[model samples]
Target: MQKMPQWADVVLIPLISLILAALLSALVILAIGENPWAALKLMVEGSLGSTYAWGYTLYYTTNFIFTGLAVAIAIHARLFNIGGEGQAMLGGLGVALIALFIPWPHWSLALLGGAVGAALFGAAWALIPAWLQAKRGSHIVITTIMFNFIAAALLNYLLIGALKPSGSMEPATGRFPEATHLPTFQDMFSTAETALFRGAPVNVSFFVALLACVAVWALIWRTRLGYEIRAFGQSESAAKYAGISPTRIIVVTMLMSGGLAGMMAINNVMGEAERLVLNAVEGAGFIGIAVALMGRSHPFGVLLAALLFGFLYQGGAELALWTSIPRELIVVIQALVILFTGALDNMVRMPLEAMFLRLRPAPKPARKTEPAE
Candidate 1:
């Protein structure tokens, strides 16, 4: 018998965690001499109020979606692929190479090429760590984390030397070809008289993120490989007995995870910046961990969680801009949300499960057994 319904696990638990995070955040604001209700109002107004705001929120959402899916996939295989930061950096390098060198006649072709490059680069970065974990006794967590620094250093070297344009001091490559420029929301949605998403960074890559979600959903639920991944996650010994190879599952899952993380570059680099630059990821790679945790490693859940964090990000920026609250306050709020959803998840889940179990009606006592007749 289940302790609670599936719906409760998927929806109710996260919702409660979010509310608790919000309440505690409100208290924090009050302690800082700000009105909680007013602050909440401002956040809503800033993040969801206008098309301009929605553009920023959705832009952030797009990045988080890719990174969140990246993390969630590895999570299903019980692997902590925190090297998303490094993988994504390499992906950006790939994007830069393709966008700067390839003379694409159209943006669509460039976008496709950029995606392929990003995925390849990201997957390549993950390959070493995956191989180490699968073939050696090396721990994946430590290996992946160490790789992040390596990626950073490698990127720094290339940016300052090989990738930098001659006579230019900037550590980033020159602007991408004009044909590679993506159509932003304003370009796609504006009318003659009015503009939507004006000056916003959101672009067609958002659709790519959505497509990724659908693909991941199908991969996890409808594919044999996914079944093996989940089976391995559930019990390596049992999966081994069933003919599933742990080594194969780990390598494949990390590759997919790293590829997804790299895809984020198509949004931030090709779409928004129109060029690859250092720190282009803006910590979205790490935020993806919280997104995956809150979403419980489901694609749809990752989408919703990504949106929530996107809102918090844009809203927090607005809050800091207009109020006395410092920018770091948003970080505090994010940390609190992570604390409740990730670390303290059992605090909410256990209580809810017990309540639901108690609410279930007692089964009727078995009829008294008389002598067999």
Candidate 2:
């Protein structure tokens, strides 16, 4: 009964969409008086040519994985938790507090502690919005959006007033204890003279992101709660009739979403900066929307989409550095990808669906006379 195979729906559609986006992007570059092919070469060379480049690409990909999973989880429950930006900010605050005050004997323990703190803080940020949506019928999108600004302001106040290290003007916490310093790729892969990651910021957090992808997959496809969440999402009325609680599903799904979003801080703050700073989330929260859309809200899809965006990010930086293209153009290119993949998805999908339907063989007519003979 399906017009397209499941493989085609999941893989072919996105692949074609990306190809179209790329062709259009190339035209745009040519129209702007730049060499599109050259730009492409530079992007590949810069983002994937060397271990150094892969380090940066993977580092960005790690952040995207966390945020993408966060968005995807809420999306599965038919909820739009746009407050990832704010939740991540609060998660950083939690990380800062733990890393600065607690003297963990080792980075492993510190990492565990940081994960707990980040998850709790992120979940807390989403709690009120989820409650309001479930209990008061408030719009989750508006409430979560408002919370982003509130989180920014709250972080600004705390960093400027209470948490700022004395005699330091920087609006960030002090460097974390040495014991909490994570092992970098350079340390893991190189000697004193030779280096793999070199100056790149990729760290153990990348592994954490990978593990999270697996965890999310299991949660979505292998767990009872996940079934209830998906059932509620598919039809609230039907789920209610089946004895599933809508309010409970909404609150729990948002909590998991926010927790995933918050854990992103462990990568940027603990693994990279070794300190909490303002704007550390760096719009990864918003980019996650596009990632989730392109991935169709599946964990495996999210991982691939996250890597693609990560390539765009790291490669775009290289493009800006080496070509006449303005840095803003990189953002424009990213937007176009998001446009074709997310907003304009049906533009590509509908045609493909029609073609596939037509390709399906027509049902043969019955031969009644021949059958009787």
* lDDT of candidate 1 over 315-362, digit per residue (tens): 999999999988787788778878998899999999999999988775
Summed backbone clashes in each candidate are 0, 0
Give the TM-score of each candidate: 0.96, 0.95
Screening candidate 1 with a backbone cut-off below 3 angstroms (N, C-alpha, C), the clashing residue pairs are none
Residue lDDT tens for model 2, 1-373: 7888898889888888788878888998899899998999999999999999999999999988999999999988899888988998888888889999998999999999998899899999999999999999999999999999999999999988888899999998888999998888988999878878898999998999999999999998899999988998899999999999999999999999999999999998999999988888988888888788788899989999999888888998898898888767656766776798778888988998899888877664445456776
Task: Identify the leading candidate in terms of lDDT.
Answer: 1
- The whole-model C-alpha lDDT of candidate 2 against the native structure comes to 0.89
The 10-residue segment of model 2 with minimum total lDDT is: 361-370
Candidate 1 Cα misplacement greater than 4 A, ranges: 365-373
